[model samples]
Target: MTEQQQEETTADQLFATIGEQADNESYDENKVVNEIESLCMNCEENGTTKLLLTVIPFFKEVILMSFECPHCGLKNSEIQSAGQIQEKACRYKLRVNSKTDMDRQIVKSEYCVSKFPELDLEIPAQRGQLTTVEGLLGNVLEDIAIGQDVRQTEQPEAYQRIQDFIEKGKKMIEGDAFPFTIIVDDISGNSWIEPKPADAQNVWSRVEYLRSPAQNARLNLGNPEAPNVDDIQPDEVHTFPASCPSCARPCDTHMKLVDIPHFKEVIIMSTACDDCGYKSNEVKTGGQIPPKGRKITLKVDDADDLALDILKSESCALTVPELALDLHPGTLGGRFTTIEGLLAQVYDELYGRVYSGNNDSREPEENKKWETFLGNLTLAREGKKDFTLILDDPLAGSYLQNPYAPDDNPNMTSEEYERTEEQNEDWGLNDMVTSGYEEDETPAVIEAPDFPAGAPAA
Candidate 1:
């Protein structure tokens, strides 16, 4: 047998062993179990440690571990993510006001820091946990009360302050503290808060930001040594070792620089995992951002228009006025695909978000509205409906194929305009001083331009 076949067979045998040890014939297909004896932290005695590897629906795989020490009657449990670190760090904020909000599920990875802004309490990175908002608060209370008895005798003032804080936490868990915010920031981007139902008004918000160099180093996700630029040929694909985002298994990523016929050069990157059969690809524009933003509007008159190739950069916002579809920037990331394929992706993203096994929770009116919107999107994807497609890119890195080539396509129009101050700030271009820093004694301040009354605000 080949080396790859041998590896697969070994993996199968290992899983079989784990299944036999678990001794459950009706275990879920997405779950595997194993057990071992480990030294207990409390008693220093051997304790049974059970590990369950399971995949969360709509999310990724995670390992759940539970330990029981018979000698000390101690028990503990924790959760660890099995997926690779994401490209950017994530922060989730949720305002808890009702009982249901306290019951919201939370996935706290080892690198996650949770904060209760109103209570002035912060829980730094510790053991990973899969719990609810109320359970998290309970754990915090337990941790804080550990040495309170000793402190009450030795340091009465400090002990009283902690007792008051613990009382507030208990009230918050009991729903007495009605409105407060819980923030979970994960540098590894593996933590998440359960999203609200489609029909419910959600008070949760999430933001993703680039990690600083120090944060990356702390997470052990720092950049590798830089490669020599001269070694990479423009036409040749360069392959490098990387981890699969889905399975966290070792894989290879291929990248190549390609030039479009009528446009500038771009870097194409692709990754495929042999173990999980997961694949992903993206396009990155080469060189610097353009000085002026671009707006492209296309009138899709027939099926032929849906076959045109398009490049939508990460900074582009797509809109379909007729279909009432407006996708903000960074919605689908960068993509080099045909119009039909892009529309299909948009349909899938929206459909999955609204109808991911929560049909019973949706109101009739909301359900019907979403159904109609999805139906129209499906028709547009199949080229059975005519609609207007608009691409607004502040970086001017997006492109739509002109079927007529040298001659302008009558159905399409393109224009360039100066970017607004807000757009520049969003792209981090305002702080970028390319030259004259050494000779300048002071920095220059830029003032915003005043516009007429009816003009749109930036």
Candidate 2:
């Protein structure tokens, strides 16, 4: 059949008239009609339709698969995979009238269309990566030792190098929680962490402890830690002035991202999509690395960052981009402040969040719910005593330092302990299943798995 064979009259709706694109690019024609004719007299009424494929995102990889729709898209994508490890036959969801002997298990979530199995090939590949730590250290090492063998290494030049590495802290990991080192090398081979931040604040260690479920990471995307290294809160759909940066359209596409690091500070990252091959400054930030070179750098959000936002927003019961732009920084030395002062400001921020979420007087269950939120028995006990705060916002440690507030709940009474126990139990169960001792294990996490087919099925 030729590409444009028409069995039925043109649809009532036309893309040319509707104005989505300049032309009709839909899969509309007789090949589909012919296929439908083989199955039933009706074609369009009971035939193929478009569907979104199930997405499996892992560390540095994305697998797209499709689900079958028996002439209509329903009861499809209903067969959820709860992180299953013990693979077995699953029943075909929408099998039509067939003989009892015709096996349906083989039909479940069609892994490949026999006619087009070459499309979704899972070809193997690999990529080399250098971590942020390695990159920064490598640069410093070259700068320091570029001509070291030519002459005797000088003294004050050596001291100056240390100062530069320590103070500049180009992309230091500041965890904002516990004591951690920020070891950085200067123009010389020496490396030392900013020790005062260790005594005064905690940035690196807390960040080191940040472990994520890597369920939706991509392959060869560099270290999984890249996300934390360039940490920004998840993307949030925010409204911008409905004017284009280039064409000045009344309705432009602008989106918002929070906590993108500016020079020694963090700020909101926003952008607009174009309508007419539009013109505007095409980059987000100009070489974040301090230099004479001035080309702007661009960073796009990934699927995992999107997932991170969903988890964080739900866990905190807080809207993503959780820390608003300049919420407390203005009161904390206008943006840049001493470590202690910054900590104070962050504490006040947490206090404000707690105060806003407070509804203790409503009911006992409400009190229990609040207790559940803190995930700390000592904090809950302190809440029972009467929650008080210093001011608008302060850093985490400062809030933890309240004289009247309960100290850290490092004991069994806390929900942290209870949660740990539950997790341990789950881990053991998972181990048992992996060992094949248990026939069917409870897959703890469940999400819709990918569909059976993709445009390019392999």
Candidate 3:
């Protein structure tokens, strides 16, 4: 058939228009077109169904596209901005203080990371779902309910935990529980939160800022071009040789110096073993090695202190001295974030052990101990009880920004002390294992196992 005839055939196959006929909805204000002779992206079925695109006028011009496959019932929906992309990634934090706040509109793009810190709920972005504050809460509850019903059939305690989270969310929505924060990180800058009235006190007091360069790069914001570390001057390239922990294969390591905010230069080191495909990485800041180990402490007096910056290295140890709480490096990975964000992560880990396990089968005494721990954690987070955060790093990588040391507050303290022999050994600072073996010992050779698609190599 001629090209014109084929085009006419495809257009004739699209018998319905999305704006007027398919759903019989009115979208007179914004332009809505349907049946563009599009194939189902999922099923790859040509001319079997029509795709819908609607321009919804809101805080920004948003183009909504949806496709459904009649053969396989596959469905997908996406939101794209009509204007130019944002120069920088943005974060929106909404304080869910009252029922009125729950009515706030939220335009969550697929690339947004939605999080409810207090409830230990985090929904990472992949698929976009536009919803309101109340609607978001409902979505969370529904997702928890459905997932628990399906996955936790054998674990009654897990179901109970999800139910408890749902109940707490409902209470927050109804203004019964303490106010919580909902933070959304949108790399595309397509997501938005309804701003409160200007007359309201501290209406925009919630945390909002442009994400860091590393963060923007991670999100593929603006398709940032990666820096070529090899292009650096020869003097800047630091190279070392190491044996892989996985297969004992000799590997070449490279450390590229890069500048970070608050720090002049930090070394990004990576080691990859080609033999067994083993890889490891570590970040070290460039500075004179102090004679003594470092100890940093911060007192959390109120909610504002939660916003204090914390840089915890993978080798650093964290302790809440007041609560007799201590966390080692292996328990959690390093993170550069605020006090509240770190606490939320620790809480989620602890919460998983308490509520999302076979706790119902455990002794009553054991359960009580966990409950007491949870109570103590809640007290520390609510600022009802004072707590001191202590960060110790044998290496000078970890840092706790002294809120008062920098400005007016006098509660924070940072000191360098001698590292105990035990502390030094624990971090492998003086361990023989860290040093490459001499010629006397031959390196072990292990065959790399085949990993399934998308699986990490072992």
Candidate 4:
């Protein structure tokens, strides 16, 4: 066929499939379209399956599907993420204390496991869903009710126990059980819980952690076997096959050990995901913890101080009194960056967390306070304001550059002090018996009571 005829034939085929010509300009990406008719699993009848390809405003692309059977009146719905997997597994914990909290939106991925600690109930990983808290509980109730009638007849005791649990779940869904906890753990890191202003407090918490090797293997990204560190040399950068945390695609992680002039040796590791353009670098200090903790204080009065390099270990606690910034250990992990870049990161982190969601829900006074704090932080980050930067590390692994080479900077001071018992416990050092653990593990012997034996014999 001619080129024009071929194009016409393709257009005709498209029109025949859809039964109409598609609108080009007025297309809605979120609109659900009938994709196909498939056999219904329940009734063996044909069911209409509709599909929606859209991107979540706060997240990424996801495919929503629904199936309905006219003959059997069967209906089903599910959601699947079309985006790449996140770099870290995520867990969301929410304290449901009111009706508003119950209405919170939840995106539960197929790899997510939800738990209700208060009710001692756990929902294992299943089909992905976009639902509210109450809706999820209602679905659980319906599932529990499915085999209940038969159980009531065959296993009366078990039926009563399950019925009681069902009643409790119903109460929770009905808002009678006001105060409870819901935890969503998603290894794929695609699930999400809607955040409210209450989340800024203890009512809600979200934590992201590195996935275990088993989890990576389950995802089918790469081999779960760990790389041999013995082959890694300090002078050469070792590259290993790995999976990208963001995309779950095959990637490489590069690691090298570098010795600082005045400081100790540290491992520098970096990972770049070509599929998603996600790059990350972290420093790992490898050495015995110092006997004493070190605290470094720098008065940033001159803009030149911001150009100084800094090494903030994972165990370092950073503080800026002037900016009212106090960050605990493990806040930003380990970093080797200039003072300006670090401050900028600190500003960005605080800004993002403070204003992550809607700010109109916050009180005017509280909003104003946060705005002022951010403004001061911005000024400090730009080196336009004076602030005192303090790095307190229990391991004494942190470092700040001294422009005076052999001499200490006039504006900087370093002090070492004994770590407190609480600090040791926090670091898990209190339980560490490096040298005499074998002696401590030896079982103690006990002799029988001779006097008691004699009395029994008499």
Per-residue lDDT over 1-458 for candidate 3, one digit per residue giving the tens place of the 0 to 100 score: 86655764554333222233334445343323455556766677853333343332224445556666777788666665544445434556666667777877677787788888888888888676656888887877877778676656788888888788788888877788757887776766667776532212123222223454555666555343555344443237678786665444578988776777665355677789887666666555565545577777777877888888777775566778666566654335446678877887777756753453123334587567667767787788777788888887766678776655447457777778888776555433453332455553764332221111110000
Number of the predicted model whose lDDT against the real structure is largest? 1
What is each predicted model's overall lDDT from 0 to 1?
Answer: 0.77, 0.24, 0.61, 0.75
Model 1 global lDDT (CA atoms, 0 to 1): 0.77
All candidates: CA RMSD (Å): 7.7, 27.7, 18.7, 12.2
Ranking by TM-score: 1, 4, 3, 2
Q: Which pairs clash inside model 1?
A: none
Residue-wise C-alpha lDDT for candidate 1, range 1-458, written one tens digit per residue: 87666875654443332224254446644445578999998889999998876544334557889999999999999999876788877777788988988988799999999999889998999999989999999999999999999999999999999999999999999999888888888889899876542312126655455676567778877563344356556899999998886556899999999987668878899999998788989887776788999999999989989999999987787888888776656657778999998998888867766664325434598678888888999999888999999999989999999989889999999999999987777566887777888788874543221111110000
Off by over 4 Å in 2: 1-135, 151-374, 377-386, 392-458
**Model 1 worst lDDT run, 10 consecutive residues:** 449-458
Per residue, candidate 4 scores C-alpha lDDT tens digits across 200-311 of 3246656555676678777775675555347456778998888875556799999998887668889899999876677888887776788999999999999999999999
Clashing pairs in 3: none
Residue 5, model 2: lDDT of 25
Better of 2 and 4 by TM-score: 4
Off by over 4 Å in 1: 1-33, 86-102, 116-122, 141-183, 196-213, 219-237, 243-252, 259-264, 272-279, 291-304, 317-332, 346-377, 384-394, 401-433, 436-458
Candidate 4, residue 331: how far the Cα is off, in Å? 5.8
Residue 291 miss distance in model 3 (angstroms): 26
